[model samples]
Target: MPAKRRPRRPADDSLAANLRFFAILMIAAILLRSLVAAPFSIPSESMLPRLLVGDYLFVAKWPYGWSRHSFPFSLAPIDGRIGGAVPARGDVIVFKTPGDNRTDYIKRLIGLPGDQVQIRGGRLILNGEPVPKLRVADFLDPVSPNSPCRPVPGLRIRLARAADGGAVCRYPRYRETLPGGRSYDVLDIGTTPADDTPVFVVPEDHYFLMGDNRDRSADSRFPAEPGGGIGYVPAENLVGRAMVTFFSTDGSAGWLMPWTWPGATRWNRIGEGF
Candidate 1:
């Protein structure tokens, strides 16, 4: 005799099956975002000349290993960190501020654990040797709604006209080479109190970070306080290393105007890698 066919599932059972499928998809997405890479948007010019406000980039999470901070809300069950590795000097990284331990701050890693870092006369001194700084052409930052070209506090504002007659902000930019020969641009607007500071020995399990925009950044040179400087961030607070810029805008696009979106996109900045 032929076997009997099974009864068809009810409509409610079918709906529950669909919901379960979606739940699995949500869990997969969360794991991917936490373990692989995640998108981050630049909100400040602290990393200017490389990263600009309105630029959206991918931050690779696996580079520095996995910690509670690597996951959303720092709720991951991991203790300390797993498979952690020391980041190279000059690697731009995103981490939680040691102050609040919740706010995200992105900066370049400068001093490793036990390394001494200081600023003298607007120059970076690492391990008692001055890092090479060469004068470069002024960075012509385009004036946009995102970048208003407003002068940094206590500095003079300089503006220029682009080839198309658009307003641009002229900044005194320089190229700084770290100890390991990693080179990047920096903006030194003028003399500031941070121009000179006592050497700070990076504590074990901590890293010293600074912004590429030297004069305007409140980094390890200042005390850890809410809404301000981030002092020697703990390694466990590391989130990820900036990988590449995927999207960018000039902050001129209105949600109501779909036609303006394409025009506002920063085409040249897309696909740029660190």
Candidate 2:
């Protein structure tokens, strides 16, 4: 004969309910961040004139498909990208730093595997051809925390008054057109050491990346350091493609100053495409 089932206890029922709810929430969050989309915050001015410090953007996970790097803790057990799609020449992307394969980095995709890339006189050289760069109006920069555009090493900056009477800093900005008509703005702080580099032949399963803020960035031009400089990023290290900026702040407001928060928000940069 079948034994009578044990009666469900109230305490046991409550504990099980709570555990189930927590599990559901964890599962949902995991799925959303992994399969759907993920939020990334810009911590530096590396991609300046395109992505600024304090910018919050969304990274679309589906563009390059899934690799082991796609999963948090990188536990996918996969070798290369699955359902992978080769990114275009000018797409802005966030990927794992080459040395660690753990640190997150955002930069423009400048070279593909086997592509010859270099910088000469601050101009990007792709496949032995110089990418066209057109000078644009000076980019007006306001005083923001950790803004790389200002306190420039060797240039005189003309100051301007903003509507709020805050001192405005100015930096030279230019438009760079890559091959196939893709173009974006970049900030140049005269010629720096990074402006000229030995020709880097992108290796198989690797990519060459550089920041729009050419003078300030230490990208593929620098050899990979354990926790610092990024070298040749592996194609499998790609996390996602930057799609849009959902929020931005200039660090003008303090946590205690709730009323000033809205004013500190960069409303104009919201919904900006990358």
Candidate 3:
């Protein structure tokens, strides 16, 4: 006769199957966020015109290769970036704020390694040549809890709705042309302290970032200390290059309310490319 077989426990087999499914799902998530793309949300007007405060977009991790910063919470134990790639002049990027590894900052890559950068009279000067800033149509921002277009430095305005239940805010806008024929929109609030800055030569393996909102942005132009301004960002700190906008909201919706999605979502901005 054949040898007797022990009975299998159905509950134990089911528990093992559940654990395996969760493990595989977690691995897939980490791989996608690390090697393919990851989602990020805009929290400020630093990247205005193209990116808004309530916009949610994807950052492509493959463009700049693998680095510790590519991982969520930067949990990797590597020394530096592997298969690293430098972001282009006009490419928008997300990186760990210099000196404060915990913070993530997004901005346009202006000064590349060894490039001389400065702001003179509300215009960007690269390598002693002034980058052209031409006046453009006013940039209109709809009045909402999310689109106040508020500038930095403790300035606040009471937002109000229009008579038609819709309103908009306006600001002076301009087109800034960087070297290599790249151009983007910028907003300027006349003159500010950053309008004139001393020439800063970008060091090797480093980059200088700036915001499209000009004077309102606290980028490499300020000290990265208690003032909380971002300074020169390192290559190893790079997270990824911004690719496209996935979703956006008007800041009037809450998580528990599903009905608000139709009105609160900015459908036009969805699938917008960076």
Candidate 4:
């Protein structure tokens, strides 16, 4: 005898369909984040001026080629195989902190592999040639407006008119030209601790990095002292290059509840290319 016809359950079918859709969505997101660009928020002012504290920037994973550091969670077991082209000097890159590989750091690459780098008399010298540095303005900490931190005693502050017709205060913008004619901005907090120091020759397969906010950044200059920076970083620790700022918000502005998102968002910085 034929058994009773089984009934198709709508609820079971719907659940299975929903699970498949969610799974697909999650996989797509993972793939996009892993292969394409991903957004990273600046947690510290170490990269200041170039990348503010609340700025969210996009890091291009393919520019320097993929390394274990390029993968999501930085879980590639193999070490240093994917660097196709060596990172150029003056490129702003994100890398793993040398002292602790677990921590990620972002800084401008000053010394390339096999390059001589030193700080003498508040100037950067690459391979015995002094990189030109011109003081442009003074930098003030917007987060702490009334803080005592100001431009160095000798240096002067320069206020530039923004495109929006508003005045923005900044510490002198110095044109620091590298040995290869790569020039970028540098900030001098007038005779800070890092201004005068000994010379360091960058070893092979390693690089010297520093923050745009020279006086405030703990970079290759300091070496794990009570309040120092981690030394030179190896090529294996490099993650990617920071390309542009995708989002930014004023750190002082935040919502107490869910209703304040519209007000808290920094509209000006949205879609603003770096």
My TM-score estimates for the predictions, one after another, are: 0.95, 0.92, 0.91, 0.81
- The lDDT leader among the candidates is 1
Q: Candidate 2 lDDT, tens digit per residue, 12-120?
A: 9999999999999998998788766899999887887787788899999999998888888788889899995899888899999987888899999999999999889
Better-scoring candidate (lDDT), 2 or 4: 2
Q: Write the per-residue lDDT of candidate 3 for residues 66-88, one digit (tens) a residue.
A: 88888878898877778856689
Over 4 Å off, model 1:
1-9, 152-156
Backbone-clash count (model 4): 11
| Two-way TM-score contest, 2 vs 3, winner | 2
Error of 1 at 33 (Å): 0.8
Off by over 4 Å in 3: 1-6, 149-165
lDDT of 4 by residue, 1-274 (tens): 9999889799989999999999999989866765667778887767666666677888877777776766777776766756457888889888878776767788999988777888887888888888888766544434332122333456555455555664565565677777677777777656766887788888887889999878779899888433358688888877778888777766434457656555555667677553
Clashing pairs in 2: none
What stretches of model 4 exceed 4 Å from their correct place?
A: 1-8, 137-170, 224-228, 256-268, 271-274
Q: Against the true structure, candidate 4 has what lDDT?
A: 0.73
Return the clash pairs for model 1, or none.
none
